[model samples]
Target: MRRAARARIDLNALRHNLSVARAAAPGSRVMAVIKADAYGHGMREAARALAGLSDAFAVSCVQEAAVLREAGITQPLVVLQGFKDDAELVEVVRLDAQTVLHEPGQLACLESSHLETPPAVWLKLDTGMHRLGFAPVEAAALVQRLRTGDLVAGHPGLMTHLACADEPARPESETQLRAFDEAVAGLPGEQSIANSAAVLRMPAAHRDWVRPGIMLYGASPLIGVSAESMGLRPVMTVGAPVVAVKPLRPGDAVGYGGTYVCERPRTLAIVAIGYGDGYPRHAPSGTPVLVRGHRCPLMGRVSMDMLGVDVTDVPDVRVGDMATLWGEGLPVDEIAEVAGTISYELLCSVGGRLQAEYVES
Candidate 1:
């Protein structure tokens, strides 16, 4: 807890974000995506915080699901990426986690298993992402096969992922949705397609289930917009402490690579966070960071353990002053933009070393 770097998660903000998803996609069951440790906000803690609010928990692997189960979280979990080996086959059943079957070998694995029970399976259709899931024709055939094979007698669902829903104006959104519809036509089970982007933009895609990932963490999928713009709040504030203070002369470069030259004599504060802690290395000079509630421009190449910021405008900024990388009043989207990525990457890439402080409203 004494470390200069930390990420404080607002458990209440996480709850509020889930509430927002529930309201946005009314009448549909909500499955909160907690993969990558709830996008690096701590899986068990985030699952515990959202235990009652979420209809189900979703993670990428059985290990993540087991963490929730160990914490007494009994909500049904759907593995976004299905099993890798037969060992997971038993774990899926034992953990009672559902899985998305996207490969031919997975179906064979399920068919070969003689266990008394098989975990519920969600058929994943490629739709348009083309990353995972079966082709439209193959997906249809697989669904029929599962229905006939008794592989998922108790529960079954159809799920698809969106690649361009974040850009509402992109034609791929509708194309993917239509492809998913055609693939699952006449299938007698629940349907899910929307991620945070679709939930906020493509209402028609909101079907029986809404799998919201980034939105649950209170960050926007679309650039230059926020949940508040859509009536939501940010959940996590990655904070660090000012470790060093130095006065820089005009034209003097600030950090390694000398990419940033001091425009004027200014006091620069070095924050104890950098690419090693998952702060983007691509973050160019002049990227904004919050110090003492004042906006300061990040003024150098991000190093392994520290980054320099121009704090000339921030009154009373000193060593050990709290600097907010994002959250609270700071918009994560703004920081993510400076990092040349989306909020999702910034949130998920935060390393495990950062101490997480969960604050319930």
Candidate 2:
């Protein structure tokens, strides 16, 4: 079935972005974060595309990792949230997956498990995120317990999440780095702290493994640094076709609520996309949409299955013309800004109804 709205997934662009991450942190291994279904790009597809390139894969939970395993992915999978209970721990062991020991209860659960072979573990230090991990002061003692308990396979690697690596001017990242370094001062294991933002900006945080999430999908993690400027290419392009075109007289209202009134005689193109297809309904007028290779301004409110675009200046725009929501010539970030959101939300929010096409080259 041909869907009116579609998203094109570019695997070549995905590889290019992975290369960019490798170049940014030459000494660190890349753990591609594929959580949230690879940021809604489709988990198994993304894992397959990145299988050979990524040193390892990181997901939010065991179920997501199981998807990759079922897809025949052999790369090591890291469960960021760790196991919720001993049953999940058994599954982690069965899948040969690694896990992060972020909280005291997780360690307690592991201590009680009697698996013949335990999965490798990463000890998360709280640093300052406060969302996960043990306090820096308590991390060393926990690490000691894990090492002596024989509950974890191999020495547990040290990991921390940075609270403000995207904000270069802030000292929070540096402070966290200092705390992480001190906590794991004499401990023996790999250290990791850099996420996508830190992988590109903070070299010091790229210790052992660099977890690149949004950057792997070619979206900028920092507010000021664009993906293109960082040598990254977008992997997804969202588009829809124009369903109707009409002439509007001055003083005529368009769409529901009559919020937008044509100031003068103009040509309007009705695009077959809207909030129902994951286009942000909150996107205000003047959002840019490309029609027939020409930039057109979106007018009025976005409806459930359509949107209004001012095609008065676009030459010969007609029904069946393709309108690019974002990708290629249009950056998703720009649309996200006009929508009062971020590109991550825009990409992840793409509805299931929209068809997806994967391009290898």
Candidate 3:
């Protein structure tokens, strides 16, 4: 634990975020999205922490779902991308996992295979994303096919991904919701249309199920909105200890490329975290890094194993002192904004090199 980068995961914060999701959609079942290694919080750890609170766990594929099952998680696992092939279909069936049939080929595969045990299914509609799922116009026919052909154990639940639910100003969320509603009119199955943004902002989109993803990790799903304003507590606090302190004279340079030239004498601290530990390489000068809870400006190019921070404003900076990269005093959103990316990318980009410390407080 000496002078190294560490990602401290607060389990209690995760529980609090789940409560926020629950309080927002009181009547809907919560399908906590834990894909991409639970957004780099460690999938097995996330599953263990959210097991009882989450109604079900949603992963990107059979492989991630398999990891959860191997970790002894008993909650219903939803394979969002569904199976990749016949072998995957068999594995999905074996895992007793719920699969989403989004394309005609997947539907055809299920119908023709005639496996001994059929998987519980959800029919995904494209609505407006135009990425995956069947067309909205074809929802009824597909649901009927799943029912009449005995391709699933029961009525297939209906789900659609929101193309622009995070952008509250956009008309796409409402349009997609309307399309989804029209597509499944009078269908007997449960419906899910609300992702994290929809869950908090558009209660109308909260149907029989609500899928909470980034918000579950205490990151804001909407643009320009702060997670702190939404009562979400950061679950992961990444900190790196100061390894060196250099006195900078006027015109002195720091980091790779010498992008930062000192205008005035300053105290610079080198922290033991950089792009190699998943810190954004492109995060420019002036990005906030918390030193003793005070904001410090990042100087020059981020290196592979270290970053330079201007800690002159803070008194008595020294080696072994920790600088918070994000979380706790800082929100991941702020870093993502300066890094020219989204919170999902920043969180998912966290590397395995850092020491992981789990905390409940």
Candidate 4:
């Protein structure tokens, strides 16, 4: 069946983006983050595409790691959240996956686990991001314990999350980096503090391993900087066909609740994509969409399975013409701005119902 709406996953672009991350952090090992299904690009497929290039793969949990393992991915898998319980710890050990011990409870779980051979562990320090990890003061003690503990396979690496790396002007990243350095003073093992933004901007934070998430999927982590500016190529392009075209007279309202009223006679092309297909429902009129490779303004509310785009200025618009919601010519960030959201949400929210086609080149 020919699907009217589809998401094209460019594997080559994915590879290119990874290279960009690597280039930014030339000395650091790359842990390609494929969590949230590689931000909705399909987990196993992304793992396969990056298997040879990426030094390691990082996921949100052990289950995601198991998925990669089941798919025959041999690269080291790092569970960012670590094991939730003893059972998960066992599974982590069984799969030979590395786990991040973010809290005392996770450490306790690991200590109590009966697994004869525990997987390698990374100790997460709560430098400034209060969301996870042990306190900076507590990091040294935990590292000491992990070093002597039976559960850890080798010298555990140290890591921390950056709270404001995206905002380059902010001092929060520097604060976090200083705290991390102080916390891990005189400590053995590798260090990792740079995320996508830090990998690109903060050279001092680029430690032994750098975890690049959204950047690997071709989205910029920093504000005022574009992915293209960072030499990153978009990996996903959402395309749908125009299903119908209507010529509306002046004062004609379009879509539900008549939210958008046309002031001038215009040609509106109904596209076979909508909130149901992960297009943001809150996207306001004037959001940009590409019709016949020309920019067109989105009109009216995005419905469940269709959206209206003003294609009057776009020449040769017709039924079955391709309309790009985001990606390629149209940046997802622009659409996200119109939707009053972020590119992360838009990319991750790509609907499961949309057919995904993977391209190598």
Candidate 5:
């Protein structure tokens, strides 16, 4: 018998979330961000599912873009981080992938590395994120530089990352938007400003293009909002089978560090998943896991390959019964909250130990 965790990927749910983004910003073009292996939902499958719906696709690097090209994804692909060196720049051109020029060195590389045909490029403006992009004040000069450069395409698209779009009440997004607008004022080419949060909450940031990342995977982008309320369905439903069961008395301790002491007569269902299988090791006791469609509280500490859950309330609980870690009936956000992390970390951290099951429905 196997003791590995499993992730059920629903392609329909992915498409539905993409539709939500599109519906939120009907005027702007959709650049579906499929980086980090489509945020651990399988990049190839996600690309195939939303091929016709998205105007473009985005990945962190050129290698990821090549994967989509090889999988017969014909839509325009944008390399979000862009090429780091000439070799990657060559591959970007060969794969016909668009790239972002965020710094002077990258522009210098582009100018030095001449190709037969220039790929489309996006100029990142560092309005406030300060991670990538050039100084917002230099937006006009940067645009002029790209337009006048030998290796640039027809026109470089203008884009910037939002610093606090998730916190809609914060003024940072407004500040960033204002800076981006002032920097690229009357500048040539398309402007992209909104991310997933901006797409759903901050409508004013929606410009020429909108990039949606986590929302496409059916995870909530807002802090307190649920994905279901935003018309999104969970795409990656993860679970593991119960391998062993044990009865504990009121004073009985469980798992490592004896973090949980039984308060009453309890039946514990030991699950076949833990930190080793990408289940958050920090998820403490009381974190909910769905067993037989009933919510069971996780007990004690999580080990490398196993975790214990209080299944006393579950009637007819037995070994080999499935216990859902997240997704399906259990929202990943709930688990993330208890673990003190984000849904993105959980999704991307799914290790090879767990088997991935992709389904159409």
Candidate 6:
């Protein structure tokens, strides 16, 4: 049996999320973002779970692509960050993975490399994000350069990430879309601009391939509608067992900072999970934690190895009672809100200290 803290992963939910992505962007191919260990849902398990469902898998580095290849995932894995050095190009090509070329430096490296054949590349255009990608004119020129000469092989596509697609009302999305459309208008093989947010909100941005990250794990990228409501199920459940229980008197300070002082006599259950275990230590007081299937409010500052939960309403909760930090009845977004972050951070930041159980479909 696993210890007090365990992370239960549901493979069925992963597949469901991919289907949701497909349904959202009916015309575009889906690229499942499995970077950061599938956003902390376990890369191999997530890849296995999403096998065949996702058109291609996307990761940040060549090493991640290699990991997927070693795990027998033969899908066309796209390296979003492209290669860091020329040496990584061989391994990337050997693994049959695609790379994203966003900067002049990467293209220069590719130009300088000696390969039997050039790998397929996805050209990222700087529509609006400004973080990574070539400007509109520069992007068009590069495509012409690659096509005119044999500097690169395989199909080259245009891809741009949305900056504010989460909020559909924002005019920036439309502006970016227009810019992207204009930039890749006549000089492209395919266009991919939609992320998880754009796929759900901006239908016009769904060009050739949609790269979805959080939505594949059933986390809501937008505020109003959740992935589950769109027929997606959560894949990760973070739970820990109560290790200690004690009665707290009124006015008793709880945990560090004395942030939460008991206003009434209440029974506190100390769960065996904390910052060290990847539970957000900055989570504010009154954060909801599931205890014995009941909603229990957190009492104080989260420690390095334990957090105090007020289980006063639960009549006879024990030290071995289970607490869900997020997942199942407790949504990751809700927990993220309390932690002053988003579900993406909460899910991906989950440390390797806890035991993980992979449930296959």
Stretches of candidate 5 off by over 4 Å are: 1-3
Better of 4 and 6 by TM-score: 4
Q: Which ten residues in a row have the lowest lDDT in candidate 2?
A: 1-10
Q: Which regions of candidate 2 are displaced past 4 Å?
A: none
lDDT (Cα, tens digit) per residue for candidate 5, span 1-361: 3346898999999989999999999999999999999999899989999998999998999889999999999999999999999999999998999999998889998888778988789999898888999998887887777777556888899999998888899999999988888888898899898999999998888898999999998899999999999999999999899999988999999999898998789999999998988899999899999999999999999999999999998899888898999998899988999999999999998857778888988
lDDT, candidate 4, 218-306, per-residue tens: 88899889889889888999999999998999999999999999999999999998888889999999899999888888888999899
**Cα RMSD of predicted structure 6:** 1.5
RMSD of each: 1.6, 1.2, 1.3, 1.2, 1.3, 1.5
In order of appearance, the predictions have TM-scores of 0.96, 0.98, 0.98, 0.98, 0.98, 0.97
**Model 6 alpha-carbon drift over 4 Å, by segment:** 1-3
In model 1, the clashing pairs are 227-232
lDDT of 2 by residue, 66-147 (tens): 8889889999999999999989999999999999999889988988888899789999989999999898998778878998
Question: What are the lDDT figures for the candidates, one per model?
Answer: 0.85, 0.90, 0.92, 0.90, 0.91, 0.87
lDDT of 1 by residue, 231-303 (tens): 7788888999999998899899888879888778999999999888988988988888889888888887999
Prediction 3 global C-alpha lDDT: 0.92
Better model by lDDT: candidate 3 vs candidate 4: 3
lDDT of 6: 0.87
lDDT of 3 by residue, 214-283 (tens): 9989999988899999999999889999999989999999877889999999999999998988999999
- Which window of 10 residues has the lowest lDDT sum in candidate 1? 147-156
- The 10-residue segment with the lowest total lDDT in model 3: 1-10
Supply the TM-score for candidate 3.
0.98
TM-score of 2: 0.98
Model 4 pairs in collision: none
